[model samples]
Target: MATGDEFPLPGSTYRGPAPHFARFRAEQPVVRVPATGGGHAWLVTRYDDVRAVLNDVRFSRAASYAPDAPRFPGLFQAPPGMIISLDPPDHTRLRTLVAQAFSVERIEGMRPRVAQLVDELLDRADSEAVTAPVDLLGRFTFPLALTVIAELLGVPSEDQERFSVWIRQFAAVDGPEDEAIAAREQLGEYMAGLVVGKTAEPGDDVLSALVRARIGEDRLDVGELIGLGYTLLGAGGDSTACQLASSVVTLLARERDTWVRLGEHPEEVPAAVEELLRWVNLPTNDTSGLPRITVEDVEIGGVTIPAGDAVFVSITSANRDEAVFGSPDELDFARGGEHLAFGHGIHQCLGAPLARIELVLALRELTRRFPAARLAVAEQELRWQPADMNHRLLELPIDLHGKGF
Candidate 1:
């Protein structure tokens, strides 16, 4: 059995790629751990094991509602209609309703707009007289993602900045519990008000579409509606922003030859995005044990996980399992798309198409405009968040080509 000491402290910042995950993958793919009190939980690391747990009906998402569920108590409270926190048939029904607004076809149609937004952001950044030390996280990635999500949800552009603050506060790594709770309440209230407005006057956005969609009588509880709004705003904006910023940083940190190869061959951009997604697995760990519950005693790779115990699946470790990925730690664009970054099975990220579109357009535009752009600071000197949940650069200072396109 493992203990808290056996896992890298959950919130500790890993500066570069995590070496510990590789070590764990080698020694213990499915490890049992002591949870609060005398209880035990399993931590599954291998690709096959993780995928199995994700799809297994016995291991339910409704585990979050268990009376004695051990979770990061302050971070998330189980909310209904949140596809991430529910089990079937509620999960199935909620996902089906929301799925209409998040379809791949709908997301694909927005690619042209995404491209235009990318070009405009780069053009504006280039126009600034002092551009060398601009933080990509702030200037390009965050704003671009925020704009996209805001427009998709029909959120008033004027209200974006205000809501953005609530998001940051709610997700802050080092906030007091009271502060975090306050932020969540504020965000809920704001979203509730917005839903009321949408009800009165429908718009051609996701929120209005959801408000008008028919499921059952109680398809969307009031809390669920507000929670969905908050979830979309936070998840859509934050994840894409981190990915966009990290892609640039990772590309520059690699050998100049690789950057040149990608820049010259635009066809490689999709492959590059996949490689980036594989390499940059930075979602918050599921200490909640909400997704997996042992209905019957199960043995994974010879490790016994007792029935009724909690389990945490490590996607980061799964993505780097040597058996599944050759040269797992190394970035290889030629490698086929097999990474679990968007997860596997029914629980895969709903925003994946949008994320891909944003990434492809951002990378293609940035490289085409500044073929010679390189990192102005050493990797060790770059500032990263203390939270291990995200691999982000606080600042990405780069030297742009003097002659702009």
Candidate 2:
């Protein structure tokens, strides 16, 4: 069995590629690792193997609730009716209701608004004038993400600061175990209250839609409603926040040719955003050892994952697998849509549409406005949260053209 010390969690520290993950993927694509909560699990890293485990019904997501199921102590548990934690039938039904809210057409409708938000942020960045030091993570990515998600959920604009505070505490990577638990409960209560208010006066927001919708008299209860809110905050906010910052930083770090090329072809923003998603691969550690207990024996990559065993899928490694992606480490905007940043199978990220819209708008606007932008600081001097879960930069001091775009 691999000891807890053998495999470092995704975001533990940034020392090039994760040593444990690299080693494990090389020697053993699937191996047992000591669970954070207890027992052990089989961590799957290869591209094909990870996809198989994700799509396999014999591997149950609901198994996380089993009496002896192993899981991280403070990780948020999906309430009943929340699609993330459910398997078939119920999962299919619950997901369908929210699916329309994130459809291609619905997300496309938000493009102009998303572009406006991006323009506003970039305008602020330019207002500072000169090559002023700015925290892209805080000033640009976080606000943009928070604003979009708040609007989508119909959260009051004035209350966003409060919502942000709750999210910070709720998603803190390092905290006392009890503190994380307390934060979760407090955030849940807050969401519960918000849901109640939305129910009383239904609005045109996603939350209201969820509250008013029904499936044969079955609807989201308070807990599940709050859980959905939490999911949006985490997925809809944090993931995009990190990715936006990382994309900006990565783009500027490259030759001026890349920025010029992108700016010249703004229509390629969608493809560029796809490349960014694959390249940055945030939330790598977010799915840490979130094992799906096997309902029956299964063979993957020639290895047998026995029944009742916990199977962990590593999204980060899978995206970089040599067998699947050519020159896997290189970033190519034209690589098309072969990556698994949104995951695979039924449980793929529901917020993917929103995330794509955010990235496309942000990147297009940034490049168009600050075509000459370049990193003012050395790559080695940049700071990041000490984990693979968030691909973010604490600050992105840049020198841009004096004239704002």
Candidate 3:
């Protein structure tokens, strides 16, 4: 490795980006590492470089699938019809058509229902904790995230259990590559049937909204629609579930004062959620972010990455950049500032608005309703999934009743 950094670079995951990333940001902001297939890929860690890579059109997301592209070998690219794979005009068109469903009005209108769901989940947790440690991931975060996205996408309740399984399979890094690919296909197939049904009988939901969406003579084909639907479920649902659950774990374990204080002033919950998003390091198996293939020789952080190379931009590191955040590693809810938690540029998360709403509402409710909540077990005792995949506590056991043993 050009930086002498091994894969899964060494660092404590306690606060953010681990310690090694901070060193890379200072010493080798842009360094090369062994690529998955066979070649080398540049790792961009500085906030400025990370943003530059994201904003520069020369770094192409679509090119990542080229047979000869330098990339991590397994699952080198998103399936063709997925939005994450598209670059400019194609990405622009699809996003325009679908963006209406995630608009401010639509997402805000969902607040009441989201609040209701959160309360219901916490109700279960509160009751169950009277007897035993309640698995907060299962009881609160997972279902709230999955249910909201499912209803938004107009997936029938009967079909949603399968949706969760498919998403988990797709998100698992330890699982066989073939199984993950199969899960993607199955999810796509399921979404194909959903589009047909929604097309025939429109519902007041995102998929139906997309079904009716058009541009002049342009409309999304079945493949594009299926791809978008599954993308929302897989990326939106699974990642949000992971982030929200992990945020909760951080609060109960690390920032118990902030956790209790936020409950006292529910209005501060949104700001607190923002800090958590910036602070929590979503554990992954790689030293890379989503890979973008260089369309031309690009200079980021004073390093020249040649054309046809894969560039891995670290959003985690960028969010923790010292130049951008004062005392960058410390989780300061009061220090409101821009961060790359949702990423940057056109490829930024489309479901970000909905996710913010979900996180804000869920946290607000939890803090208010169960202000005495505490971890039932030591932080190390929390069962995290294999580090090969995204690190998420498999189950978060909490004492929701304020009675800690």
Best by TM-score: 3
In angstroms, the error of model 2 at 265 is 1.3
**Candidate 2 overall lDDT versus native:** 0.74
User: Where does candidate 2 stray beyond 4 Å?
Assistant: 1-5, 9-27, 35-39, 72-81, 284-289, 387-389, 402-405
On the 0 to 100 scale, the lDDT of residue 81 in model 2 is: 49
The clash count for each model shown is 0, 2, 0
Q: What's the ranking of the predictions by TM-score, best on top?
A: 3, 1, 2
Rank order by lDDT, top first? Answer: 3, 2, 1
Give the CA lDDT, 0 to 100, for residue 97 in model 3: 84
Q: Model 2, poorest ten-residue lDDT window?
A: 7-16
TM-scores of the models, in the given order? 0.90, 0.89, 0.95
Between candidates 1 and 2, name the one with more favorable lDDT: 2
Q: Write candidate 2's Cα lDDT for 8-103 as tens digits.
A: 353332222455666667888887776565666687988888888888998888877888766655344444445678898878877876674566
Model 3 whole-model lDDT (C-alpha atoms)? 0.80
Q: Kindly report which residue stretches of model 1 are placed more than 4 angstroms away from their true locations once superposed.
A: 1-17, 34-40, 73-81, 129-131, 216-218, 284-291, 402-405
For model 3, give the 10-residue run with minimal summed lDDT: 69-78
lDDT of 3 at 343: 81
Alpha-carbon deviation at 211 in model 2, angstroms? 1.7
What is candidate 3's lDDT per residue for 298-322, written digit by digit as tens?
8888888889987778788888889
